[model samples]
Target chain A: MEIYNYMGYELIEKIRSKEITIQEVIQQTYERIEETEELLHSFVYLSKERALKRAKNLDAQLKNGKTTGKVLGLPIGVKDLICIKDSPTTCGSKILEEYRPPYNATVIDYLIEREGAISVGRTNMDEFAMGSSTENSSYGPTYNPWDLERVPGGSSGGSSSCVASGQTPISLGSDTGGSIRCPAAYCGIVGIKPTYGRVSRYGLVSYANSLDQIGPLGRCVYDVALILEIIAGYDPLDSTTVDIGVDEYTKELNRSIEKKTLGIPKEFFGEGLQKDVKEKVKKSINKLEGLGANVVDLSFPHLEYTIPTYYLIAMSEASSNLERYDGLRYGKMSDDLKGDVYEVFSRTRGERFGSEVRRRIILGTYTLSAGYYDMFYIKALKVRTLIKKDFQNAFEQCDAIVCPTMPTTAFKIGELVDDPLQMYLMDVLTCPVNLAGLPGLSIPCDYDNKGLPIGFQIIGNYFDEKTILNIGYQLEQELNIYRKIPPLTIRGN
Target chain B: MSKKEELSKETIEHISKLALLDLTEEEKEKLSKQLGDILNYFKKLDDLDTTNVKPTTHPIDGLKNVFREDIPGESLSNEEATKNAQHKKDGYFKAPRILKE
Candidate 1:
């Protein structure tokens, strides 16, 4: 049996049936990692010895007639931003490169307790989850498995790359703008940004607190659904976590989209979108309509401002959130302190932060500074409310909003390296959901002529992830676009 | 798209100081140019009317007490916390003394 080609659900079945031991699965995963990691550069830290130890414990439990939960013995790749006890959670920043977390994140606890999931390792990410492509990671950029020269998307890029290359069946990523979805789109994997507060964000190492959400990225919708079911719930620890009962997402996998109404927001596909992406999105929509969904034209006039509004709010929050890293409490400190208290702090920060992080921090500080607060930060917040209101009004007319996940397919690595603003613009289609606190899913829709994957994004009303998944599942069954794997073995370039 | 404001080298130094950043002359010039472009972009926001709109801090409404309870939560040991520090001594973060009375 070709183990790497199997989905997480299939692997779970094998474990339950005793056809293969969980340890064997883990060994095979490590074998694949060792074989391909040189070209892929997906992981920042691999906990092979620790992961095998966890797998053995799980195996003993299952042998004794005890099953931890649905995702028993599944190998899960965690993004470095999510704190895992005893493992390094660098968030791809050099300042905290060697810092090992002392506590597991709430989601990590959930995965460990209820699912018995083995956290194989921590994957790389953009520095402090700040950039659009993983190229910004201090370690190195994780290359696209599809085309080695192309980039796997950013922030969550390492996680997405691991899943795409079959190094792990599933992974966890945090979305603060399009960090999760963009990488998923670029890598041709399934990524879901669960409704804000649906998944606890207690130990996520805050990038932008309001925008940051821990979500699942997997090869199949069911796998993502299973992970979400395990990790999402009300946590008093996280007051933003709603008191809503967690839904059985796996059960909703087969939910039909018959008679379902889908809204295609026209503004998403109009300008700045590539022709190839437009064609693929149209084909996917047609395929969805063919599968009994009623596609309608939807308008959110305020959509044009999603990018600007998102940057302002995200940078402002990031500026405040990052202040805690001021040499005294957490992260690194420089030794060149020859000045007063304030000057010492300045010197420490000046030496620690990277260029992009410093840029955002300064911009955010200026916006939040005394005289400019009302002009930049406050106005952006007002616009954010209007953006949410736009989605609320649109959802009232349609069940979900469908659009292209990104303007174009994955651009070549180093293409936008010099232009920070241009790279930021790639997240234009995705930031609105975070602004509105809505749920969105990015699924593989089609591939461009070059065989690079194109993704279609479906956003739902707050806490309506099941409906979005249902539509995605329906389309998945009809189109089956994920069957085409990129020809990485042949080119080897 | 309005009148482009050229930031003086001295003003760049001042902003960098306020931002707690120590930049070289070359870095200062490059950043000053990039920051000027970004600040100009933000100027576009001036056209919007935010007459009485309250700034939205947390995305969710009624965001109160998002902190986890302090019930013997796991914390980093002094050793672990100071392990990544460039300089440390005796399980504590070491820094140059600041106050000279």
Candidate 2:
């Protein structure tokens, strides 16, 4: 296999044994990136010089017998929304195109300084992590590696696309209402949205503070587990993070999930779910049953309200979180001061933000406004409680909930861009997990007749990521479907 | 109260102002219609009986204000803080004049 074909954990072992130099891995990665990037459009910024320098330093340390961090010399792609000091964290928006952060996110610090991972580039995303398809990205959409004309899902589309195309073995993405899982499902890879507050949100550019979480995307379940082990922990900087022990996620990967009951949410299999997706998910459930796991039919009474509840709460939080980008402190500024302070704020934001962002902001402000607060915002919060209770009730009957990660596989570019509601519905199955603040993992199970990958989601109770990871690992071993590289990746060979 | 299902153009304009966004005429028209559709969808939440349920502002339960000792520690230097500012003057962010002198 080519060097780029090896997963991050495999590369780390090889590099540590001195069989391959970090420089060789870095060079091969960039070569693959150069070959496939134009067609995939997966990245916004490539830090070639810095990455090579870091790799050279790590290689010297390895030769000198100096101890390096756990994921030594691994190349990783980060979603543009995460702050990396001295890099242009554009968040796929034109407003912050020139803005460079002076501080790294806690997760970046853990990955680079502690884990010895080299960040290869900043991947593209939906602007402010808002849209379900990366078509909302101002830098242009990231095409699915599976099919060039299809979208790779968003707002973390670039992260998932890079992993799927073998451009990067592991990457980081933030999920706010299924940003990570949607892309992971569409691109046919492994991605997890860790339970809310399991990972710190200190440096993440907030879309919806209440729902957003930073997680890992990789080609396999173990790679996802490895990255999660490194990045998940308590951070003093983020008060919302639960002060709990971070498990060695890989330790439990080989454990059997036999006799564990899995809940199949009946609502997820109904209506908008495509037929092929349902079949693949059902087959995966049977595979689990074949592995000695039991399956039970479960119903979430409030499942229909997930989209509305999620949108209301997410938009309300986003309007408040995004109010900080008014051109005064950081983002793009207008040439003229215009009429007044209010005009400067409005004009700069109006001209800089994309239409979807503008629409959400307007909706959010309206929902939170005095006349509508009780009716929309407060009512949504109440429904959010009910959603949480629904998950709690379902978890009482099973170890985890298994469902199709998305309603369908990769949709064509420009397919749902003009229709916002249809695009929002793309997250129908995944957002319920986010709404309830549970850990959700997406791993490729089967493909449609079109040869596009379909993902099955494993959702666990609050902070119980280990259960879902173990379950996903068992199914992944049984299926063994992730080894096929996209035809675009073969072009790099 | 009667069902005020459709969002008016005036309401969208007011919302744009509140969100600190300046919308062109075409955008206003499109947004008004779109927001109305979305709001109509959100109206589904009204059917649920949430009379006694407490609103869940955050996901995790038993979350308290995490307090720490008020001890001085190293902080970001002014240069680092203002490095990304679009307009900086004399080590401070420069903004448009808000009040007349």
Candidate 3:
């Protein structure tokens, strides 16, 4: 029997009941990987032997009555940008072709060592977690399982694709200005980018430090909530992590959405939104209203400046953070090591870093350079202040803000690759959440005429993940769409 | 908005040098135009008067000086440290000479 087809919650019940062994789940997961990997290309590496051995050990422990953490026997696909000690954490860039982290990220320890969730393997991502589409990956673009020719949304695209296609029950994804949420929205699954500093960033590779956050993507909101509970909390290793404490997210999932006020940012629904996406989101808002949630339409004046503020600040930090790859200690250094230090650094980076990576680095360097520093980088930071205030003001009147995750549904693969500005525009509604360091949830709300999923984004106040989650949980119960698997999963099988 | 800022080829070369990236003419040409366009759009910020707005480098307010006890901790060992390096000499990473011989 294909026990892997079950959700994490169901799989846990069955594992506890001894109805199915962990080995059977592992076998079926590998069977699915073997079946779908060719067309989907969701994974960069598969820990087949290790997972098989681990499964046997877990099954033996269950028989021996040994303790297992929550989500025991569940399989998780981790994005390549996160470190998995001794595994190839590629960040989907050839610069780190042979690189393996010596120590597990704090999140990996929580998921694998502490929590007992099994690692299916490292998944793919954008090079250095830069792009919105997984096409920026040196491994090549991951196909959207919903539509073969379309993209799986990116940076965290592989993580989203794996769960949507049912290769793993849940996966880890990092969001630095919508990396996690964008792909989650595009792929038709549940993903959460928690309030900044909520999840420890110790093991996740840095792209933009101030904005980078580690989060989870899952087949449903409950699974995403489950992983968040496991991975969140303070860690001395990551000082940015707060000691604010994690709530019983799964338990709170049943909370009613009545009396909760949701803000509809008028600017989010303005000019660029596609007609179908707008209609579906408005209809979902009506559904929330029908469920007794109060809806308020408010104007967010500074919304137009989000892309510029997000891109400028993010790229500037990314440029500074990425200076570590000198080719001597990590990744594949350029072959022309015979030159002096400067030449070696230039040559190695020039040869190894992808086009998008290099472009951002140069632009970032310019932003921080003399004469332009105040006019560009500092101005972006000040604008970040204004944008952050915009969220603060909105949250004062609402429990959560609801909007379309993307201006449109998933586009064809390679559609916006050459046009960087057009591609950056894809994060229009999503990046503002990151700028404010607030929690954002992308849930599959409705499907367009093409059967492509449209995501409804819920932005909540700092550390108020529960309210947004309760809203998502209530909506999910109302919609009953979590069990709808993508056609590619079935077709490939 | 700031007279439509543009990046010249010389500026790209200079910044590329500072960024330690060697770029071909094609990349230089492309980045010059693309980065120019992006910077121009960023001029939109000037529209809002951020006169007294303090720059927010970190998102969470009131988090500062997260100091801990002054002590050593478990970390990557020497062998593990250089495990992914392509070249090594006597437990140290071997890199090209820093200065011209």
Give TM per candidate. 0.94, 0.98, 0.98
Best by lDDT: 2
Q: Every model's DockQ, to 2 decimals?
A: 0.49, 0.83, 0.87
What is the per-residue lDDT of model 1 for residues A282-352, given as tens digits with 9 covering 90 to 100?
Answer: 98888888878897888888877777788888888888888777576456667666767667777777777
Question: Over the stretch A1-493, how does candidate 3's per-residue lDDT look in tens digits?
Answer: 4654677788878877888888888889889989888988999889999988988998888889895778778888999988988888888988889888998999989988887888988888889999988898988888888987888998898999999988998899999888888888888999999999999999888999899999999878888888898999999899999889799898998877889999998999999898999999999898999999998888898999999999999989989999998878988987666679999889999998999999999989988989889988998899999999888889889999999999999888777988999999888898988898999999999898888889999999999888888899888888888888888832221
Which scores greater on DockQ, model 1 or model 3? Answer: 3
Ranking by DockQ: 3, 2, 1
List candidate 2 segments past 4 Å from native.
A489-493, B1-4
lDDT score of model 3? 0.88
Per-model fnat list: 0.48, 0.84, 0.89
Task: For residue A43, give model 1's deviation from the true position in Å.
Answer: 0.8
| Model 3 Cα lDDT, one tens digit per residue, B1-101 | 55989899999999999999999999889888988887887788888888798999999999987887889988778999988999898999887888767
Q: After superposition, how far is residue A78 of candidate 2 from its true place, in Å?
A: 0.4
